[model samples]
Target: IAEFNSSRKLIPASNTKLISTGLAIRGLGPSFRFSTRLGYSGYISNGTLHGDLYIIGGGDPTIASGDRMTVKTDSLFAKWTRALRVAGIRKIHGHVIGDGRFFDGPIENDTWSYNDLGTDYGTGGNGLCFNRNIQTFSVSPTTVEGKVNAEVTYPATPWIEFRNCAVTARPGTGDNLYQFNTDLAPVAELRGSLAIDKGQKKESFSNKFGALTCAWEFAKYLEKLGINVTESPADIDPYDNIRYTEAWGKDSTRTGFRYGNMAESPENLTLVYETKSPSLKEIAKVTNSRSDNFYAETLIRMLAKKRTGSANYDSCKVVIIREMDSLGVDMSYGAQIKDGSGLSRHDYIAPEFFCRYLKAMSASPVFKQWLYTVGIAGEGTMAARLQGQSESLKHRIKMKSGSMNGVLCYSGYVMPSPGKPEDDMIIFSIMTNNCPEGGSKVRSFIDGLLMRIAK
Candidate 1:
């Protein structure tokens, strides 16, 4: 309210999640849930499925998160195995296919930097997102100085290979490891140093080829349960990679099978296993509170699929812009929305635009659900922020904070103080971009600003 640059286009950082999450709750409906269907496209005559086992993707990002963003591998997959057994399917003579057609976009957004592609924050959104597109590496220092070795990856798969070039530094040196790889590239390079720890250290890295990697792991799981997958992931993934990459101009090579197309019919094939993700409410909670880039990107694409029948990035942007227009928000406030995560430097939005969206959302039926997704005064990214506040103020301030390089942003709802009318709560957005002093300084400035506003 004082000395503000509300209309300046600036990088929103992760605060953009607020917009994507807000719009998603209204556009997709709070009750909407992402569903993944499992069906076998084959005949089972003598306890053996003669045709392919199909795993169709429904743009569900929580398949790997299990329930509520925690990994629940056994129960869900066990249901599939049990269903297969009950259906009299013991042996599968064909390939285990992953159908990712629900989403038809490039694995990596064009606006995302090449440097951000393969890290935990950079994992591309997929029609079939498993384990949140992440793989954890357990690392320890070797006897030799300046060298560290990595053990096995969790939910291990034969699809990805790692090249360890990490160095071990003296204690208190801290972690300096870096990963390099293309979104769907088969190999990843690990570089940098970590402070030597007597105890093994664990780090989670992202994979661009998560859908296929997850399918390969599922195939191995089926193999353990007496089912054989005759076809290798090399064959299936290349076919899929080709299909997804063609739109991005990364590959033009023709492939045999169209993995995105629906399998023949459910009558001929048995429904082996089906999984439904947490509702949109929970997903948006994780997106805004945790600042989950993958989920944010996935939600936008899902909206695009709902409106345009295609999950590409362009469609998503168009759909989002159109929705804002319908809501009477100025499109010029955020002239362009390149990616859902706000990871792209090309992304630009004015703080006024975010506040307008938040204000508009507050009037909607789903406003409570949307508000619940943001971090409260002392949770998630808001931890240690707005500390020592009055009890009433603590519960009333809900915000989503975003910081990337020189950009720091916060946007959401701040409820009314005691003695104030309930409707007096404010919707606000503050973004500081290109701050030479970095995130901590900008956040300190924001805290001071909030205190002044509160008084």
Candidate 2:
């Protein structure tokens, strides 16, 4: 390694996903898929579903968002509608419930800063998630100074409300808005102001109720199809009151309040329609390509839930560490991973440990799939990056970029340069924390360093 401080524990930022995604690729394999099921808890009598219409969340990230690779429109609702029709059910008499119990515990990470909680990137992961757990708000400049106008949230969540306190600023001031919301709390507030010159700006904010949103959206779709839904979409929070048994694992005292209402299990639910997400390889492609916090967290928690029967922060870390240890990578080498998204300040990892993990994972059968998901120099999150690199140079490098506040990190593989037969490919890890000059400056420096290393 060019830098001698490899053993020093630093915030790997989004680089944390590299480790988690690698674990997923090797452990879960490339063909693993997340499945969401559409079923009914009660009997289907002639034209009516006597009990709850259950939309069970299997932690599928691509339910509504079209696959990033194929660009196929997600006709999820249409598929469900057809299934319902084939089942001879024309009406749902009971509540349309969203069940996302695959993963348990709180929605938002307890370690995440309050500042990051409301932004789209900080949106927490759950068993049932839809629309990337995001809410879109459009703001317009008001004619009166210091007063901005915000439109109602898109996709229209009637259950949740917004308190717009944003103001209009002078031209050239730019948008300086911040949104605040909690995992189960329905209300949100928009604070700060937008520039008057900026007309009709749309901003994306994260929310805690993805399953609710998904069910709500599907209910609306069913209505359009002349299939009557009696009540609005709702979610049954299984994690509401987790039994405090020691065998359940995790500290019961640290468990946060579970949001939403609780309902009886849909264990005996009859199948109606089912949706399968793109393979894990494709998911890793999107998650790493965009450095998606939601997907990363989901994958990690899913893994934890599968192995430990719990998806809380502590359980996830336990499982991840155990997985690495099983692979002969001693996680005790100064690595502390609190959240999968790397948004929490509680996360810490030594460059040496990360590099060691990468090197070990390089020989995996699904390594190529994992490599292809990360952004190339001119694609995905890196679409506007590596400005001066040749196409060949760009293709030779695949990277996952991470930056938040004073932390910036990049970790991935660098193939041997063209025509350099004897040159060895490199798996590199670099992290810069508390950079006084900011993330861009650190990224520029890292870019310069990579060029020299690639040579």
Using lDDT, give the best candidate's number.
2
Model 2 spans with C-alpha error above 4 angstroms? 69-74, 143-145, 238-262, 418-423, 437-441
Error of 1 at 57 (Å): 0.9
Candidate 1 lands at a TM-score of 0.88
Candidate whose TM-score is highest: 2
Residue 223 CA error for candidate 2 (Å)? 1.2
Across 1-455, the per-residue lDDT of candidate 2 in tens digits comes to 57668899988888888877888877777888888888886787889888778888888877666455432333667778888889988998766777777778888788889878889899886888777888788788986466678765665565565688888888999988888987555678888889888999788888677877777677777877888877556676545421111111123122222233346565777877777888888888778878888889988887887788888878988999898987778987769889887888888988888778877777667777787776777787777667798888878877777777788777777887877653377888888889875566767778888777766
lDDT value for candidate 1? 0.74
Estimate, for each residue in 1-455, the C-alpha lDDT of model 1 and write its tens digit: 54388888898889888878888888999879888777776588888888777677788888767545543776777877787888888887766666665687687788887667767888885677778888788888765355788765775544445678888888877777778876445567888887776548788777766666556667778887777666543213433432221110122222222333334443555676677777898899988777889999998888889989988888988998888887778786555688888998998888777877887778778888788787887788788777777756767778888888888888877788778897888777888888886466667778877766665
Candidate 1 ranges with C-alpha deviation above 4 Å = 66-71, 143-145, 169-173, 196-199, 230-273
List the lowest-lDDT window of 10 residues for candidate 2. 243-252
lDDT of 2: 0.76
